[model samples]
Target: MALTDDVTSCLIDNNKLFKDIIYTAQYTATSANHLGYNDSSKHNSSSNSSNSSNSKPLPPCFDLKDAYRTQAFATTTVPHDIENPSVKRIQRRLVDKFLLTMRSFISSLLSLPILALLVSVAIYKTTVLHLQSSGDQRHHSMDEKKEALDELLSQDETYYIRRWGYACDTHQVLTPDGYILKMHRIYKKGPPEPSQGAKDTKKKPPVLLGHGLFQCSGAFVLNEEKSLAFMLVDAGYDVWVGNNRSIAGFGHISLSHKDHEYWNWGLKELGVYDFCSMVDHVKVHSQVDKVAYIGHSQGNAQAFVALSLCPEIADSLSCFIALAPAVYAGELVKNFPLSLLIGLNDWFYTLLFGNGCFLPIMSVAQQIIGPKIFCFMAYSMFSYLFNWWDHHWLRRRKAKYFQFTPRPVSVRLISDWISGWGRQGVLLYVQSPPPPPPPQQQQDGYRATSMTTTTVSSMPLPLSAVGSKRKLPLVVFYGTADYLVDGQKFVEKVQTCNPFPMLDLVHVERLEGYEHMDTIWGHDNHITTYPIILDQLSKVSYP
Candidate 1:
C-alpha cells in the first residue's frame, strides 16, 4: 500500500542521512585537527625564543624585520607555550565544538522520519477516506455488483442482523454496577410451540453467543444463513448474543457519556457483572433454569473467569462450548517477523489507543481502506496472525472477513491482547466449593430465603489445590494452526492448575481444517462445526 511504501522510503531516507552525517563528521574532525596543528607550531617557536638565554636568530633572507622594515615585532609580549595544559585544553574545545555541530545536524535530520511516518499514515488514510465519501462510481462501466456494494456501504448492525430469517431484539440489561448493556437476541419467528412431552416436541435450551475481540454480535449472522446464530435457531434453540462493554452501545444508566465513569471499566468488570446479569435476564425471560454458553477468543476467556469465580456455573449452565478458546499464547503465531510484528503492534496500539473504545471500522481506519475494501484490508493485515498462506483458502475467505470483524471493541479489553504488552491469558481454575446457586422458588408462589449475596472464590493463587480433584465438563473446538489455541499447553495448564484431568479434554475430533474464526462463521460451519456443538448440548437433560 501507499502507506507501506512511504514508510519504506522514510526508512531508506533515514539510512542515507545517517551515512551522510558520518562522512561530514569525519571531514569536520580532520579539518579541525589540521588547523590546531598549524597554530600549535607557531606558539612553540615563539615560546622557545623567549625562554632560551642563547637565542637563535633567523637567516637574513627570512628575517621579519627586513621584510617589514621595522624593529623586532615580538617585544615585551609573554610568548605562549604550546606544550602548556591550557593550550591543549583550547585545542580540545575547538574539536568538541565541531563534533557538537555535526551531532546536532544529524539529530535534526533523523527526527524528520518520525514526522514523515505520521504524515504518510495520515495522507494515505485521508486519500482512501475521501474516495469512500465521494460515491461517484460511474467510471466502473456500470457493474451491478458495484451497485450492490454501494448500497451495502451504509448498512448498520441492525440491518445486517435482520438479513437472515431470524428476528433481532436489543434488550437493555442493567448490571448491578449500573452499566446498562444492550444485549441482542435472535429467535425464530412463529406461533409459540408446545410446552408438552419431550418425545413429541423437544424444545431446545436457551443459548447465548459471546462475541470475541473488536467485534459485535453481527459476527454470528455474518455468514448469511450459515452463521452460528441462524444454525442454532434452525436446530431449535433460543439464541441470544451478549455484547460486552467493549461495543459502542452499552453505558451506565446514571453516568452520562460525558462523565468519566462511563469509560472507567475493564475486562474484569465485564466478567464479574455484565455476563451474570445478562444470564439472569435471559433465564427470567426464557423461563429456563439452565443455559448453554458459547464464546470465541476473549469471549471465552471472560466466561472462564466468571466460572472460576463461581464454579456452580457448570450446574447453572448445561454445558460450555469454546470455539478456538483464547486461553493464552506462548507467542503470536510461531514465526520470526510475526513475533516482532506482535511486539510492535502492541506498542503502536498503546501509542494510538490510550483509553475508551477502539473503532477501527467507524474511525479514521475506514477512510484509509474504505468500506468496500474492508475485507481485503482485514485479510491482508491479519493474514500474518493465521496460517493462511494457501492461495486457495485466502481466495475463498477474503470476501467474507469484513462482515464478521473489525467492529468496535473496548480498548481496555482488546489492548491487553492485541498490543502484546502482556501475556493476556485466562485466570486459573481453583479447587474450592461451588458457589451457592440463586434461591429456589417455593411451591406456594414465594421465594425461599436467599443466602449471602456475594460469592468469592478463596483458592490460593498459582495452583495450590490440584489434589482436590474437581472438574467441569467442557467442549473445545480448535485448530492445529491457531497460536492462541495451543492444545497441549491448554490441557496441561488446566490439569496442573485446576483439579480437572487433562486426559478428559473434549475436543472436536471430526472437524479438522478449521482455524480460530472459522469455528463460528465458516461457510460450511453448519455441516462441520454445528454437529459437534449440538452433540455436546444433546447430552444435557432438558426438563
Candidate 2:
C-alpha cells in the first residue's frame, strides 16, 4: 500500500517519475522474498485491496496508480477490438492533416508561374491595341506629311532656282588615258559685294566636296535649304560636289566606251586614276594653282592614295579635310564586321570578285536587302539611342528629301573593299613582314623600280615608292568612340611612319562624342566643327 501511494504521488507530480517508483518497488519486493520474509501474502493482499478500492470509486486519497495500471493493462489485453478502432481513428486524422499541408504547398509553388502568365497575356493585349491605334494615327499623319512635302518642294524650287540662282552643270573631263570622267559642278552666282579687289579675287573659294561609300554628291547636297552645298554657297564658298566614278552623277561615260567593262572600277583604280584625273581637270577648269579638298569616308581614302602616289597633286592641294576618313583601313576596321570577313577570305577574294565580274551571290543579297530609306531610318534611330547625334541628323536630314535618280554601283568594288585592296595600303604600313636578310652578296640585292604607273597589284607599293625620307605635313583627326576606326592604333602607326626632321607634323585631333559617320553627317557639322578645320587650313601655305 505504501508503494502504491508513493507511485500515485510520483505520477501526479510528473509522469516520468512513475517509472522510477515502479522499478524501486519491484526491487524491494524481490529482496524481501529472497531474504525469506514470511509476510509476502500480507503485502500482496494489501496491494490487491488498495487496487480494488480505487477501481470502485473511492476517496481522493485512494491510490490512482492501481486504477491507471488496471486501465493500461485492459487496453493492452483487448488488442483485437478497441485497439484497432483507436489506431484507425488516429491514422485517418494524420492522413487528412498531411493532405491539407501538401495542397497548400503545391498552390504556393504554382502562384508565381500563374501570375506571370496572366501578366504576359495582359501585356500582349495592350501591345496589340497600341499597335492598332498607332496605325490609325499614321494614316492621319500621312495626309499631313503630303501637305508638308508639297510646301517643302515649293520652297525648294524658290530657294534653289528662283532666289539663289543655283545651277547643276554636268561636264566631262578627258583623262590622259582618254577616259571621259563625269563631273557635276553645283555653283551659285557670286554674292553681292564691292569690287575693291581683282575681278577674279571676288570669286568664292572653291570647296570640293566628296561623298562616302554607296553615296553620291547628292548625299551631301541633299536639299535646297539644308544641303551642305547650299550652306557653303550661302557662306560664299564655290560648292563643287564631286561624285566619284561609278556613282549616280558620275556614271556617264563617253559614247565610244559606254559598253566597256573597264569604266566600272573599284576605289583601287579610282584612287589611282579617277581621282588623279579629276584633280587635274578641276585645276585646269578653275585655273587655280591649289584647291581645298573636303572628303568623306571613301573619298578620303581616294584622296590619300592619289596624293601619296602622285606627289604632283600635293602642290595642287591647298588643304585636306577628311571627314570619317578611311585612310588606314587596318586601324579603321577594328570594330567593324567587314574586317573579320575580309581576314577570313583575303586569299580567296580575287577568285570571288575579280576581272570586272561582279559576284552574283553578293549582288542578289544586296538587291534583296539593299540600304533603303527605311533601313537607314532604323539604323539612325539606333544610333540616336547610343548618342550618335551625327547619324541621327543624317537620318532626319535625308528623310526630308527624296532621291530622284539613285544608281547601282558595281559589287566588285564592294568586294575589293572587303577583300584586300582597300586594306592593303594600311596593312603594309602597320603589319610589316620580316625583311629578307640583307642580300647574301651586293649583286643579289633587289633594286627599286622607277615606274609611276598606278595599276599595281593589291600589295602595297615599295617603301621606296612611299618615300620614307619625305616628312609631309600629316594631320589625322579621329573620333574616340568611332566604331569603324581605331583612333589609338591609327595615331601609333602614323608616328611609326617617322616623317621626321622636315617638320614631322603629326597633328592628331580627337573629336569628342563623335561616331564613325558623325564627322560628316552630324547636324552641327557646319557650325560646330567646320570652323576649327578652316582655321587649320588657314595655316597651310598653298604653292
Candidate 3:
C-alpha cells in the first residue's frame, strides 16, 4: 500500500491519471497475496480471523462463500449493465502506451540499413562520372595525333615533275671543287603569237623558281593549287624550278675530290656556290641578259647571299619575288620551339639521321601510322595553339598539290640551315670584322681572304649588300599569330638595311591566323596574301 501511494503520488505530480489507476490495481493484487488466498488454504487462519470478527457466530466458511456468491448473483440480475468509467479509461491508456513503444522500436530497427544504402549509391555515382570524364580526354588526345600524320604524307608530289615537263635535258654541273650540282632546263614556247605581229618580237624573259632549305625545286612546283611555278607558268612566264644542292633532285651531285669536305657546307656555301652556279647556268641556257627570280624561304636567303657576294647578279635579276623570304634568321628566335630546335646539338641530329635528312624518317612514320593518325597529330600539336581554322582558309584558296620524293636527304643539310645560320653565323659576322685593305689590295686579296677564312666574320659578304648603289628590295610577310617567325622583327630587320626610298619602309604584314608552314601551304594564302604579291609583281618592269 505504501508503494502504491508513492507511485500514485508521482503519477499525479506528472498529470498522468491513467498511470495512477494502474498502480492502484497492482496494490490490490499485493493485498490478496498477504491474505493467503491460495486454493489449498481453504480454512486458513486468515479466514478464521475474518469469521471471529463478525458480530454473529459464523455457521461455516462455506456459508460465507455462499453469501458472497448470492450477492454477485444479485448484482448480475440487475437490469442495467453499465461498465466502469475508470476501467474504460485504463484500457484506452494501455493501448496507446503499447503503440508508442512499438513505433519507437520499429523506427530504431530500420534507421541503420537505410542510411548505409543511401551512402553507397552516392559513392557509386561519383566514381562512375569521374571515370567517364577521364576516358573522354584520352580519346581526344589520340584522335589529334592521328590527323597530323596524315596531312604531312598527303602533300603533292606530281607538281614537281609537271614543272619539268618542258625540260630539254637534265645535266650535272660540276664545281671547280669537284662537287656536282644537278640542273634541269625547262624550255619555253614563243609568246602568244606576238599579238598579231605588232613590230616588237622580243622573247619573254625566263622566270626561275628556287625552293628553300631542307626542300628541293620540287617543293616550289609540288602544290599545283598553290605552286609558285604553276602561278608563274599561268602568268605567261617561262618557269624553271631550281633544285638546290643536297635536296631530292640535287643531292647526288659529286663534289670535287679536292674538296670532299665541301659536302659538309651548309647554307653559307649554298649561297656562295650553289645559287651562283644556278643563276649563271640559267642565263646561259635562256640566252637572256636578265631573268625574273622568285625565291621562297631558304631560296630567298640564297638570293641575298648571291647578290651580296656577286653584286653583278643584280644586273641579271630583272625583278625578284621573294615568298616568305628568310633573309634575317634572327627574326625566327621569337618562336619558342623553333628556338629550341635550332639550338639543339647539330651533330647529335646528324648522328641520328646519318645523312642529316628528315623526310625519310617522317615518311616511314607516316606509312606506319596512316593518314588519319598524321592528320590527328597535326591538329593536336598545331591547331589549338595557332588557330588553324585561318590556315584552313588559306589552304582552301590554293590548288591542292602532292609532294614526291626520290629518297630522304641527309640531315646534315637541314642542321646547317637551322643551326649554322642566324645565331652562329650572325654572331660570327658581327664579332669578327674583316680587315680593311688598301683599295688596290681589295679585289684579289678579298677573294683569297673569303676562301681561306673558316670563321663567320671572315666569310662572304652580307646578303643585304647585293648591288653597289642599291640593296636588294626586301619584302617580308608573316602571320601575326604565327608560331614560327616573328613578323614584326622581320619587318624591322629589313628597315635596318635601308632599302630604296621608292620601296616602302617595310613590306612586312601578318596573316591573321597562319603558322610557320601555313604561310605557303595554308589554304587562305592564295586569297589573302598571294594576291598582294601578284599585284606588286605586275607593277615591276624588266629592263
TM-score per model over all chains: 0.58, 0.53, 0.51
Q: Report the C-alpha lDDT of model 2 over 65-168, residue by residue, as the tens digit.
A: 23222222221111111111111112247787676456444543543354345445544554454466553423223323432243232212223433346665
Sum up the clashes in candidate 2.
Answer: 0
TM-score of 2: 0.53
Q: Rank the candidates by TM-score, best first.
A: 1, 2, 3
Candidate 1 lDDT over 278-352, as tens digits, reads 666577557787778888877776676566544444545666777776665644535543444344433343344
lDDT of 3 by residue, 155-177 (tens): 43432444334233354443222
Q: Between the candidate structures 1 and 2, which one is better when assessed by TM-score? A: 1
| C-alpha RMSD of candidate 3 | 48.9
The C-alpha RMSD of each candidate to the native structure, in angstroms, is: 29.1, 43.5, 48.9
Cα lDDT of all candidates, in order?
Answer: 0.50, 0.44, 0.43
Compute the lDDT for candidate 3: 0.43
Between the candidate structures 1 and 3, which one is better when assessed by lDDT? 1
Deviation in Å, model 1, residue 503 alpha carbon:
13
Q: Candidate 1 or 3, higher TM-score?
A: 1
Taking the candidates one at a time, how many backbone clashes does each contain? 3, 0, 54
